[model samples]
Target: MDTRHFTFALRHHMVADTLLLEFHGELDAWADLELAPRVAALLRRRRRAVLVDLRSVTFLDAGGLRLLLRISERSPRRKGRVRLVLDSPQILRVLRITGVDGVFTVLGELPVPFAADDTPDDTDVPA
Candidate 1:
């Protein structure tokens, strides 16, 4: 058996009280197995919105997408939301092709301080 480990560095940007988490590493199988849970835990903060920056990510696979979907689905229950800051065409295509592009809100880049007028609907997300 081959043991593979992924090294990840996480940074956060505050936008309108929301948190945008930037990932630095390959969000692949290894990441899903070892890093996803940690990332999710880190994101479980007191906020209404969060964004995962996948721009610096070198590789992404099904597991990676699944992790995002899981986070997006779970975030709302906590009165919060999760979005993606993906700039790569390949990454965008993957999300769109998977038909999950609608599942997560994507921004042009990582928006800081969720615009003054940019208020999200209070569906499950808290005000």
Candidate 2:
């Protein structure tokens, strides 16, 4: 496996009621360690929209896909909403071939201040 870009980054941005988790670099199995736990924690604590920006991700593997799957399956029930920002054709193709794309609300770009399903008192929750 290529480790050239194995390192990944997860950034938190809160705008209005939406929380954006912007990602960069490879999102493979190892990436789950960095992203999954954080997302899970966010779901448990925050009641707001979540925008996962995967546009800068250079690579993805099953490990990374699993994290996305978990978020797609669990966030709606546990949080306000979940959306994925994808721009990589390679990553999109992988998701498509694996049928993982069907489960997510994919977008080319993030919508500023994503509207939440329910309004809660604004809080500074870290992701």
Best by TM-score: 2
Q: Which segments of model 1 are wrong by more than 4 Å?
A: 1-8, 13-16, 77-81, 112-127
TM-score of 1: 0.71
lDDT of 1: 0.64
lDDT of each: 0.64, 0.71
What's model 2's lDDT at 115?
33
lDDT string for model 2 (1-90, tens) is 554544876666566656666777788777787567777777665545677778878998898899888876656444434778988899
- Relative to the true structure, candidate 2 reaches a TM of 0.75
Clashes in model 1: which pairs? Answer: 15-113, 15-114, 16-113, 16-114
Tens-place lDDT per residue, model 1, 1-127, is 3333335445555666566566666666666666666656655665676677788777778977777776776563454346788788988888888897887777667564543433333211101
Overlapping backbone residue pairs in candidate 1 total 4
